[model samples]
Target chain A: MKFSVVVFPGSNCDDDAFQAVRSGLGQPVSFVWHGSEDLENADAVILPGGFSYGDYLRTGAIARFSPVMSAVKRFAAGGGLVLGICNGFQILLETGLLPGAMLCNSNLRFICRPVHLRVENASLPFTRSTRVGQVLTIPIAHAEGNYFADERTLAELQRQGRIVFRYCALGGEVTPETNPNGSIDSIAGIANEEGNVIGMMPHPERASDARLGSTDGLYIFRSLLDWFEQMRNAECGVRSQAAVPHSALRTPHSK
Target chain B: MKAKVFVALKRTVLDPQGKTILAALRDLGYADVADVRQGKFFEIGLSDGLGAEQARQQIERIARDVLTNPVIEEFSYQVEP
Candidate 1:
């Protein structure tokens, strides 16, 4: 499936994501400028990590209003696949594509280290390559990766199993110290109820390369490919369900 | 017209930066400091004809879409009339 990565003004990881999917997987990929309106026939749209607008007004704050975000929002609304990593996750939060927000890391520093993330929902396109509880080592480089949702929303998310990833220690439960960021319930990633869009604070693309000492993130890319391919086939087939919007799939209370 | 938007993390959500600042304040002998919550401030200068309501709406739009993460932070603003 064709893929496109968005490049915001200060986006620094678009190249890495492009290389990982295009060169690493030998797949067709292109970069779409933040001001562009085209999705370029891409089956998947990824907002790669990096400080967009220098993370000045809040990590994803300024980037969310970029010209391209409106298009991305439209695409996601149309049930197209979307993934936001790190600062991209912040952007998704800003765009309201994904609910919730990120806060300063618990340590109050730019944490740049390998963190152990446990897969909680392998059934989703973002984590299908691994089983629930599978441990993946990926690096998180950000000052604000801590996730927070209100008590009622948190309960709803828990009840819905929307919680997808959690910071965990090797062979241990996710705890305060093990939670790299002060994410509630150690949340690292979450998907909208429909699961077409995902936002995660960890850089899965960074870990997709085996030479990076961890190929754990490759499964995510593979899962995304499989998901898009399936959706493409479904669209061509007799299924009238392909065009439903993600916003329509949100909780009835959500506007 | 201009407005300074102050966005701060919710009390329920931990604020490491604010906490660090609080710690520094307490350590530096500011004993009366009750609490500290780190936040962001944005100075938005609008058109000359911008009314307070119009400006608030515009600023809130930016806040919802950018200036603040609604899940964790709440934003307030003051107008410079």
Candidate 2:
């Protein structure tokens, strides 16, 4: 599967995402500049983390107007897969691809550390490689990572199982002390209603390599590849309920 | 024409920076200080081609769609002739 990593002007993690897909996941990947209006046949798009537009006007306010975002929005509307990490998650929220908004961390300090995340929904394409309630150690680095949504939206997300990941302890306990950014409901990540778009504060790319002390992040990239493989087999009329159920693959844009 | 916009976190949202400032103020012996809510201010200059009504509309749009994230923040703006 081919991946396109969107690179905004201030995107510092583009290379990290590229490397994760290319070397870690062993998939073909390319960097799509923010000014580009096309995704260039990308099977999946990734918005990597960084302070785009110097984070001026707001964390993602300026970057949301980038030319590439329109293309991304269209791709998502078409049911194409999109994974947003860190500041990319902020961009996704600002673009309305995902619900809710981000606020400054409750402690008023920039947090940079490896935090544990519990997979809340493994049936989705993004978390198919993990199990429900499984804890993975992933690093989170940001100041405005506190996720916020209204009570109604929160209840809706909960009801739909769209809350994909939550900050948790090593033992898989969700607690206030374990929430690094004070995100509402301990949310570390979430998926859109269609299940194709995912936005998360954790830096999965940064954790994809063993040399980086943890390869737990590789599961997310692997899950995408797994999804693509399952899609390809389905296209060939080969029924394989090996891992993900055929019913779970509701991705309409898979080709 | 010119416009001024002020943006602030909604009442339901928590403002850690504002709370920290409030603590500092109280520490300084300002017993009457009730609260401190941080906000952002912006001054925008309009181009010559726009009329008064047009400028007001444009500024309102800018403040609504750009200056504030309606999910968590709100804005108030003033246009000067």
Candidate 3:
């Protein structure tokens, strides 16, 4: 599957995402400018991390109003796969594709270090390859990664299993100390109800390569590929069945 | 017309900066201070041709939707005619 890495004006992680997909994973990938309205035949779009628009008027607020966001919204509405990492996650929240908003870290400091994330839901396309309750070490770098939602929204998310990952210790135990940010319920990543769109503060692209000290993040990308392949195979099966006349089909017992 | 908008975190939300400031204040021997909250202020100058009432409504809309995030923040505005 082809992947498009969006490069906003201040997107610093665009190159990292591109390299991870192109070199690390050996997938077809390209960089799409934030001003471009078209996704350029990309099956999956990655909104890489960065302080877009200098994080002015709030992180992701101004970036959401950019021309490319309209196209991204359209793409998402069409059931296209979209992954927003870090600042990209903030943009997704601002775009209303994801619920909740980011607040300042509880410590009021920019945290940049590897943290453990437990796979909360393994049935979604983003985490299907991961085992539930598995701990993956991924690096998070942000000052406003604290996630918050209203009680109703939080209940809905929990009930729907939209939460894809949670901050946890090495033993897969979720605790306040493991939560680098004061995110409600230690939420580190979440997906939309349909699970096609996912937003996470931790940088999976940064951890995809073994040289980066961890290869656990590669499972997420691998899972997407596996899901897409299954979809394609299912579609092909339906088409092939339609090609044959009903009369030509015979019951296996009769044959 | 000129307007001032105040944006602040919702009451239910935790404000780390506000808590840090409160701690600092207490450390400075201001023991009587009960609490502290941090917020943002914006002074907007409108040059639209609308009348005072119309401008006030427009500024309110802007402050509610643009100057603040409804999910995490609350905003109040005062207009000067």
TM-score of model 2's chain A: 0.93
| DockQ winner between candidates 2 and 3 | 2
- What is the DockQ score of candidate 1, to 2 decimals? 0.71
**List of chain A TM-scores, every candidate:** 0.89, 0.93, 0.92
Give TM per candidate: 0.87, 0.94, 0.93
What is the C-alpha lDDT profile of model 3 across A1-255, one tens digit per residue? 778888888989988888877777666777777788988777789999989989988899988988889989999999999999999999999999999999999999999999999999999888889989999999999999999999999999999999999999999999998899999999999999889999999999999888999988898898987787777769777523232111221111210
| Stretches of model 3 off by over 4 angstroms after superposition | A238-255
Question: Listing every candidate in turn, what is its Cα RMSD in Å to the true structure after a full C-alpha superposition?
Answer: 7.2, 5.3, 8.8
Q: Higher-TM-score candidate among 1 and 2?
A: 2
TM-score of chain A of 1: 0.89
lDDT of model 1 at position A35 = 79
Scored against the true structure, residue A178 in model 1 reaches a CA lDDT of 88
Q: How many residue pairs clash in each candidate?
A: 0, 0, 0
Task: Give stretches of model 1 more than 4 Å off.
Answer: A231-255, B46-66
| Candidate 1 lDDT tens digits, A128-227 | 7679998888899998887878888788878888889899998747888888778889998999888889998888788877788887878889888667
Error of 2 at A206 (Å): 0.7
DockQ of predicted model 3: 0.74
Candidate 2 ranges with C-alpha deviation above 4 Å = A239-255
